[model samples]
Target: MLYNIIFIALFIFVIYVFYKKYSKKAKTIPPHWHSILLKEVAFYKNLEPSEQKRFQDRMMQFLAEVYIDSVDFEIEELDTILIASSAVIPVFSFKEWHYPTVTGIIVYPDHFNEDFEFSNKSESRRIAGVVGTGRLEGKMILSRKALRHGFSNKTDKGNTAIHEFVHLIDKMDDNIDGIPEILMQNMNAIPWLKLVHDKMEAINNDKSDIRAYGGTKQAEFFAVASEYFFERPKLMKRKHPELFKMMAECFRVKF
Candidate 1:
């Protein structure tokens, strides 16, 4: 009788603790921009009404669950981040994963320089014009100017947020390669590599609108592809039909 009573008490205590944790988590709202205008900005005007509604709900839920840190920016500057986040929500709707590992966002005034230690060699390198950086476990650093430039330039085929977020996605498998697990699961690695190789060859032969940065590595290819996927979907579809199809399948969205 005594043991039964103690066991019941322990179970109740565990349940209480879990309930308290969940309730506390539920009470916290996501970080928001200072002005209402930032919240109102919409980047997906081209989406259908039904799709837009769905995306809005998902974005709200995502924001509520994920922590966002906005640094040293006026209320208006935050509008771009809000709009970009809202726009990308639709791309994630097909997957069950709602949140990324990234919890913090560090924003700079403009493009910044970063030093990197080479993995293969005992050498240090410096890179300039760094717009953004995304870590595997929920940390992102970005430049405000780069963010604006990414969204503002429609024809440039460069998107800093998308690029960083793609790195975050790539890190899901604890690998920084361009191939995310979702794409790898659905497509063969060999074919993906072959396609990328062919594309890089074409890009090198003549500068395609895909951008020169994409030729740096396979990981960069994924990031660059993500930019085009969202920015120039029609062009990507027209130019690389199969690759575009694969991206659509991985992201669980229709072009």
Candidate 2:
């Protein structure tokens, strides 16, 4: 009897804490939003019915907490869902995960350059997304067209939003090194580093199937490889089994 009472109390406390975390309480995911998720979001649609509800609740919570605004283009409901979905996919296994580094998201109508200019006339406008620093800290800017393109194609095995969000996750330990100390324990550090180095060599030598950008640096490698992991889990596992396992451990989820 005493144990049962204690268990009930603990359960209630957990629920209360979760409720207090987001007191703003997001509105229900509208029918239109449901349709969008069902049709557009492969990860959400593939989840079990109960898990899909959980995913929706998290999406609503994110939408409530993180304001998505447009710079020069009108964002559709689909765009909003895509942004939130990108944020959710990486940390979905954690019940209380949040993007502490991101305060607001600014979406440009198209690609931008180092100066944040997105006009098509600029030949140097090549950047797809960037996490802010300096005066622009606590903000993330993304190309709306690139954002849509990330999800539109599954064959490329890349998602710019996911890549950027993984960077945020990589920064949680206050270090932007390719090694995510938060996700990687001290014991696994050497193996993870060695594995990263070897794979980077393959990428640099044009022998690996991973993207070439990953070979540029460890931080970029982690983000780029994360994109490949989430977008094409089966292919990654079949080709790079070790990297696949480490990524699964890092995200605490496997597709």
Candidate 3:
């Protein structure tokens, strides 16, 4: 009985210590609005003062909850990446799935190579890209160069971080076919599939601004669409209204 009481007391003490430490960290972190880093996030700069404040609050909450890797990378650059990513939140606002499945972001100096196995084949192939990969458990790998390109290439219709993050979102329900659970929930899968298929066909026929890579697969289509959706919302709205609407509903933000 004495040993049991001692064990209980130790557990309570440990919990108390952890809570105190967490509280201290929380207190030291300044409010999002005052974060000097926000000045560096390009997208944040484009927003109106009120919208910027809203985004700042959202970003601050995200930083508090998510494990961000700023080491070996400029803090301002990291802030820009996170802010750009957080913009997706408004796009997915109509859905209950706001937070990314990946909670941790690992930034790399540049594009990295990874060996991926092909189905029904014994050989593995090496692939290189800006953002290497992601998982549903809130883990994402980003290439700094790719991230910059995604933001820089307004006409290219490719964003590595957004592409990889979209994959993470699609994997939230443990499936990765370019269709996220939230987008599929209240909508018919056929239309979504058909729209993507048609878009891919149009791309192949040189009828769209989407890159050839976007026509590679349904997953690629989703990622490419995300690039266009964010970088050229007005163009996407004018060219593919339904697709734009679906993406808007998926992200819950107005373009």
TM-score per candidate:
0.71, 0.89, 0.69
Query: lDDT score of model 1?
Result: 0.61
Candidate 2 Cα deviation (angstroms), residue 39: 1.7
Task: Give the per-residue lDDT digits (tens) of candidate 3, residues 1-255.
Answer: 999999999999989865543443222234554444344444556677777566555554445445656436564545454544543443434322344455566665555455422223424322223233444245566666666666665566566776776776777677778888756687778888999999999999989778788898998888779877777788889988988999887776665
Model 3 ranges off by over 4 Å: 1-48, 70-100, 115-138
lDDT, residue 215, model 3: 90
> Which pairs of residues clash in candidate 1, taking residues 3 or more apart in a chain or in different chains?
101-138, 102-138, 103-138
Go through the candidates in order and give each one's C-alpha lDDT.
Answer: 0.61, 0.87, 0.63
lDDT (0-100) at residue 58 of candidate 3?
Answer: 56
For model 1, state the Cα shift of residue 154 in Å. 2.2
Which is the winner by lDDT between candidate 1 and candidate 3?
3
User: Candidate 1, 128: how far from true, in Å?
Assistant: 8.8
Stretches off by above 4 angstroms in model 2 are 1-22, 185-187
Give me the runs in candidate 1 sitting further than 4 Å from their true place.
1-43, 70-72, 75-77, 80-90, 115-137
Which numbered prediction scores highest in TM-score against the true structure?
2
| Global Cα lDDT for candidate 2 | 0.87
lDDT of 1 by residue, 108-157 (tens): 55554454222234343222123234442455666666676766677766
Q: What tens-digit string does per-residue lDDT give for candidate 2 at 58-137?
A: 98888887788998768888889999999998888887877767778999998889999878777798899988999988
Error of 1 at 233 (Å): 0.7
